[model samples]
Target: MRKAVLLALFSLGFISCVSVKNLPQNPSPYISKIDLVKGVKQEGERIVPVPFKGKIGENPVIFLILKNAEGKNRVKFRLYAGKTLREEYEISFGKPGEYYSRVIIWQGLKARKKGTYTLAIFLNESLLAIKKFRIEGLRQGP
Candidate 1:
């Protein structure tokens, strides 16, 4: 009885391990690390990032880093307020070699009301990343 229990437990563990190994792992191969910042400034040859928090002011920037990017590619940005789509933008790049650690920026996104907002980024029609932020304390004009 003891040997039978031990054999069954070992078989179950082996099956679990095999199942885990067979599971697919998927991650973006081109872009990583997306952030919403107040602004970015170039100091000498290095780019300095200013972190943004709480209520955003005029001109918020979307900063992201790219890796292993090659050929011609298109990146699309979609902004949403709650479930409503607010704005959409697209940019294209054509290069021959692989891009390792390239910084891309998007500007001119305005949030006029007080609510939660979502930014979705797509690379060549594939969804890459999403960021959520909130805006509060805006006075209505008379």
Candidate 2:
């Protein structure tokens, strides 16, 4: 009985140490680029993130490039209006094979009010990146 108990403990120790790497949840995945850009513009064959003031009607874009991602990953986006949490979104990633790399583009977002805002990106409940931007004032009619 004592030998069986010792074996069980050793098995549990080995299982705890053996972890699947390259997952966003474990040890965190690698993020090559995370940018809050105005929009994606094609210059030649490459798309780039351009900086500009975010306006009310215009859509705010986020471009991200990730590496070392595996199957079934969760990404969360939070937009905080000052100290209050204003907007939130959850995204999933499922790509075949290991040593994964991909470019993710998020768009079609608008601000409700003109103020300073913070954008936070999380990978499987882990904070991956954060950005700060301001939405301009509303247009006035003459």
Write down the TM-score of every candidate: 0.67, 0.62
Candidate 1's C-alpha lDDT? Answer: 0.75
Instruction: Score each candidate by Cα lDDT.
Output: 0.75, 0.73
Model 1 CA deviation exceeding 4 Å by range: 1-28, 53-55, 96-101, 139-142
lDDT of 2 by residue, 48-131 (tens): 777765442334677788776777788888888887897888878786554455655565445657788888889889898888
Model 2 clash tally? 0
Candidate 1 per-residue lDDT over residues 20-120, each given as its tens digit = 54676443456656777788888898776677666575447877776656567888889999989999988888676645346465555667677888988
How well does model 2 score by local distance difference test? 0.73
Worst 10 residues of 2 by lDDT: 51-60
